[model samples]
Target: MIFTSERLVVKTITEAHKKEFVELLTAEEIITAIPQQRPSEEDINVKFEKAIGFDGDISKNPLNIFGVFEEGEDELIGLVAFLTNDDGDRELGYRFRKPYWGKGYATEITKRMIDYSFSELKLDKITADVWVENVASNKVLSKFLKPTKEFYNEYDNCTDRRYTLLKEDWN
Candidate 1:
């Protein structure tokens, strides 16, 4: 799937986009935004390749991650995506290269994802978990979703704040 805003182009990942994904994902500064540490290029390649493969069969792809790009650029500046939880619910997530921080790209991409989730996917709810200390990310989440809960997440080994946006309330 592809989504176009006035200044951004969000689309499903593809094999040709591997190089750019690696660059943004492996940056030391960028890596801090999420739970994962700096990953080897091979690890990124494997994961990105899987996402790209799923992009071809979105109906079967549980992890619906998208590659976000600026309108005039070929580089990957950020990502807007969701992962299926064990309960079969979607958990929203977003991240961007450190250089792109403070440019409002996170907010822009997230708003688009929320719109797509409610309007295109017809989702009843989209949940999110953000590191309790990630003030930057929380600001974006707060703008579009309501804080619902908080807990310690073993996967990230950090306290997480949960947020959710329901389709009926979003519109």
Candidate 2:
């Protein structure tokens, strides 16, 4: 799916985007935000190839991973993804280059994805899990979902806060 906002374009990740995707995804800033997953350039290209033909499902749901590009330059500044959680809730995740931090781009794209999840996907709820120390992400998620739970991430060795927004509360 393609979603365009005033400052950015959120388009589905495609094979054509392999090179850019690799560079952006492996950037230090993105690695810090998404600690669990970091792939080499070759691995990223392979994943992009695999994602080319994705179709959604409740279980093993294919993600709608979009390249977040600035308005004029076709270059990507980041990425945003929506996937179905184990409980059938739509989960949102995103990361941006450090240079793009503090500019409200994350919140803007996030709000757009939330609208798509509720209105287009007809999702019942949207949730995000963010590291407690990642204050920017916490603030962004708080703009949409109230914090409902907390847990420890053994791998990252950090506390994670889970937030959610119900479809009825979205308007």
Candidate 3:
């Protein structure tokens, strides 16, 4: 499944995208945002395998991950994902390369994914958890969703702000 916007092409991960995906996932910016403590080559390979094997079966509730690529160069710039909930809701996640930051790519891909989640997946709602210190992510989510709660992730030791957007809230 590929979704095209004005400046990006959000496509399913493939074997051919492994090398670039590894580079992006391990990039310092991404590591800082998502905190992959030891994102070695082997770890990236495992991620690639999981992403490439994703199938849109609601029962299995596979993660729908997409690589964001530039329109002309077609280079992978970031990743956006929707992990299905047991109740048919979807949790959204995204990260962009440092170079692509501040360019609205995250917001663009996010909005597109939200649309796809509701229209295509027939989901009831979409949710996101952003670290309190991640101002950029907080800003993005604020632009598209409304806050629901605040919580702490014991594993990451970070305060997370939870936001949600119901299908009817989309305009």
Q: Against the true structure, whose TM-score is highest?
A: 1
Q: For residues 53-132, could you state the per-residue lDDT of candidate 1 as single tens digits? A: 66454435677677888897777777766777655778878788777889988888888888877777778899888888
Candidate 1 deviant stretches above 4 angstroms: 40-42, 55-59
The 10-residue segment of model 3 with minimum total lDDT is: 56-65
lDDT of 3 at 33: 75
State how far residue 60 of model 1 sits from its true place (Å): 3.8
Residue range 1-171, candidate 2, lDDT tens digits? 467877988776666676667766677766776555567667776657655655643235556666788887767678887775555667898887777888989899889988888877777888888888888888888998899988887766678888999999999
**lDDT (0 to 1) per candidate:** 0.77, 0.76, 0.77
Per-residue lDDT tens digits of candidate 3, residues 56-142? 553255566678888876667788877753345568888877889999988888888788778877877889888888888888889
Measured on C-alpha atoms, candidate 1 has an lDDT of: 0.77
Q: Where does candidate 3 clash, by residue pair?
A: none
Model 2: residues with Cα > 4 Å off, grouped in runs: 40-43, 55-60, 155-157
- Ranking of models by lDDT: 1, 3, 2
Pairwise lDDT winner, candidates 2 and 3: 3
